[model samples]
Target: MIAEGVKAPAFSLPDASGRMISLSDCIGQKVLVIFYPGDDTPVCTAQLCDYRNNVLEFTRRGIAVLGISGDSVESHRLFAEKHELPFTLLSDSDKRVAKAFDALGFLGMSQRAYVLVDETGVVLLAYSDFLPVTYQPMKDLLARIDAAS
Candidate 1:
């Protein structure tokens, strides 16, 4: 994982709608970059749904939540729509971005992880679970963000 206090690596990926989203686009805002294993798996679904359910907490803190996976844009679109996820779901089909953040797992899958980037683009937190079933709750992430601030 990228170390805290380091500048976040820049990345441009397609969102569910196929629009390119870049880390530079959020230069002046805090962003929670969530790296997940896949789109519709049981754990991935639960993990994303947790964030989707509490999306207001992030928005209220002026934070943007971005979910990324190795899934294609079409897959991301279907997953987000099916889950009613309000946050942006990004496609990292090449796993380049995932590797940069150390979220790449065995077999080129994206490891379930979270990277918190501050308004200045510095990493505040970098965490990844060894197992796909584990995930950090939105509240815990919010707490980390609050404490970091």
Candidate 2:
């Protein structure tokens, strides 16, 4: 996994709308990058929905949330629409971004992971959970954001 305090690897990927989004575009804001295995799966859906439900809190703090997975743009669109997710879901179909973040596991799927990066592109937090049902909770992410500030 990428370590805290390191510069985050830059990436440009397609969002649900098929528009390209680059990490550089968020250079002046805190970014929460979530790397999950797939879309529409039970745990992935629940985790993203939880983030969606708390999006306001993140917005209030000037933080941007992004979800990345190996799924295609079409799949991302369907999943985001179904869940009503307010944040961007980027398609990493080649798993290149996942590899950059060291999120890919032995199974060739991204292990559930998160990288909280500050405005300058420095990583503030790096966490991953191998088990599908478990994830880094929103409250913990909030606490880390507060601490980072």
Candidate 3:
């Protein structure tokens, strides 16, 4: 897992709309990247819904929430549409971004992890949820930023 205070790797991956979603674009803003193994699975679905439900709260704190998976762009598109995800869902077909962030393992699947980056792209919080039972842990990320401020 990535440690706190490390500079996250820069990335430019395609979103559901094929737009290049670059980490640099989000550098000056708070960013929350959620890495999941696949789309439409029960745990993944619940995890995403957790983010969706608390998305307004995150935005209220000036945070951008992004979901990344090795799933194809089409899968992301359907998942986002089906869930009405208000934020971006990044596509990592070849897991390039996954490898860079060390969010993957030798099993060839994106792990269930969360990374919080400050305005400078330095990681302030990191967690890997083996079984995410709730979304409230994300609030801890916001708390960390507030404490830093």
Candidate 4:
């Protein structure tokens, strides 16, 4: 995983609508970038829904949530629409972005991980779990972001 306090690598990946979104575009807001394994899977679904449920709180704090996976944009679109996820779901079909963040595992799948990036693009927290069924709790993630701020 990328270390906290290191500069986040720049990236521009396609969103569900096929529009490119770059880290630089989020320079003025705290960003929570989540790298998950795939779309429609049980653990991944639950993890994303957790974030979706708390999206209002994140927005209130000016934090932007982004979900990245190797899934295609179409899959992302369907998943986001089905779950009513308000965040941007970026398509990393080639795993380039995941590899850059060190979230890609030996199986060529992204580990369940997240990086909390400050407004200035410095990583505030970097966390990942190799176990697909395990994910960091939403409250814990929020606390870290709060402490960082």
Q: How many residue pairs clash in each candidate?
A: 0, 0, 0, 0
Residues 26-82, model 3: lDDT tens digits:
978989888888889887887788778878778788889888999888889999999
- Per-residue error for 79 in candidate 2, Å, reads 0.4
> What TM-score number comes out for model 3?
0.88
Tell me the tens digit of each residue's lDDT in model 4 across 28-82. Answer: 8899999999999998998889888988879989999999999999999999999
Give candidate 4 regions above 4 Å deviation: none
Best by lDDT: 4
Model 2, poorest ten-residue lDDT window?
Answer: 129-138
Candidate 3 residue-pair clash tally: 0
lDDT of 1 by residue, 8-56 (tens): 9999999999999999999999999999989999999999999888888
TM-score of model 2 (CA atoms) = 0.95
Residue 89, candidate 4: C-alpha displacement in angstroms? 0.2
Candidate 2 residue-wise lDDT, 1-149, digit = tens: 99899999999999999999999999999998999989989889888888898899899999899999999999999999999999999999999999999999889998899888999999998878857678767898688678876
Give RMSD to native, each candidate: 1.1, 1.1, 2.3, 1.1
Q: What lDDT, from 0 to 1, does candidate 3 have?
A: 0.82
TM-score of each: 0.95, 0.95, 0.88, 0.95
- Collision pairs in model 3: none
Comparing 2 with 3 on TM-score, the higher-scoring candidate is 2
